[model samples]
Target: MAMGKVPGDSEGGDEVGFAEINITPLTDIFLVLLIIFMVTSSVIVQQAPSGGAQTGLKVNLPKGGATDVTARATDMSVAILSDGRFVLGGNIVTEDELKRAFNDAQQKDPDTIVIVQADEGVPHGTVVQVMELAKGAGLGQLAIGVREPQ
Candidate 1:
């Protein structure tokens, strides 16, 4: 709000009303909306499910003495169940399909690392076979997934 006189009016005359736009309220609304968006975005990210073996078949990973390693975007995850089932990319896959997947990954990126997650009850030979399959498909980097010792 403001007060001003007409151009020809005397300075000592009565003051006339002049409207002035106020933006404080508009600024406050935008700041509140920004905060709401930030809060909701963080909540959504925290609630989202992770993509990989964690979402695949349940496997009781054996405890290992190796240091912890985090998953990478380009890394491939393969899971072997206790009953000798093969799971790739969150789906049960045949040995042939698994080989195709490895080949595709290797063709896409030869340096792609394969992370094998075998159940504690899985046979040692099965793990070796899967590793050899990856090697045959031209994938060299391999890693074994294990849980940290309690």
Candidate 2:
């Protein structure tokens, strides 16, 4: 019996040795792959788009239609139904009440944005009227909401 090699009777004039598993090469490959994945993930994270304002001119209309305009959400959402009923955050509200709500929201933050989500069947004039109210409240960051195309 040898210290490293398995004991084999010296018969039939044949020479054979036991094979041992090595871990050093496998560990080295694993470390290299891990570093590559970490660096690639960081680069992907940095390249993603940031949360920022998007601006674009509405397309295919004479600036009066709302079909192509995009409407984004704000921290404050106001809804106007087809029946001229107004609601703020799902609660029924009168025009004066809505104005007061806007006043309160404005007092909290000057840069507060307002979103108007109205029914498509509602008259454009009605939506404009709501916009006028928002303007009077000194809320310039206005966004009109629309349903996405199916």
Candidate 3:
């Protein structure tokens, strides 16, 4: 708030004050809050897990020299845990369920690529079995997920 005196209107030398609302402080507060929210929102979005994928799982992928593969909206993901658990599209799926899910994806899009993310400690047979299932379900495009060498 601001106060100003009307000097000429008071003949008795008594100054009358007028009140004015100052908005600079309020504007500064809003701007600070906006910046805080912007930064926090961006951090939250970056940490947020992607849908229909095993984003939360910690699979130590083997570093390789394979070409980079970009993810697409129609792509399917199969995560094989080190403990022999199978996660299909972010859900724990049995072998039968995995087969059904692959078939469903194949029917939905014949070109849908199935990316297999298996832990480095996982058995080779398990990985091969998953690949075979994907092929048996009529999915031709398959990719093995591997991290780039540092």
Best candidate, lDDT: 1
Between prediction 1 and prediction 2, the one with superior TM-score is 1
lDDT of 3 by residue, 7-88 (tens): 6765565455566667899999999999999987765553324455434434567896556778899999899999999997
What is the full ranking by lDDT, best candidate first? Answer: 1, 3, 2
What are the TM-scores, per candidate, against the unseen true structure? 0.55, 0.51, 0.55
User: What's the count of clashing pairs in each model shown?
Assistant: 0, 0, 0
What Cα-based lDDT does every candidate model obtain? 0.87, 0.75, 0.85
Q: After the best TM-score superposition of candidate 2, give how far the Cα of residue 123 lies from its true spot, in angstroms.
A: 1.0
Model 1 per-residue lDDT tens digits across residues 48-124:
14553333334467996555666788789999999999999899999999999999999999989999999999999
Which window of ten consecutive residues has the lowest lDDT sum in model 3?
Answer: 46-55
TM-score of 1: 0.55
Model 3 quality (TM-score): 0.55
Which residue pairs in candidate 2 have backbone atoms (N, alpha carbon, C) closer than 3 angstroms, thus clashing? Answer: none
Give a tens-digit lDDT track for model 2, residues 1-150. Answer: 213433565454545454666789999999999999998776545422345443233235356664553433435788999898998977999999988888887787767778889987899998888888878988877887767679
List residue ranges in candidate 1 displaced over 4 A.
1-67
Candidate 2 regions exceeding 4 Å error are 1-74
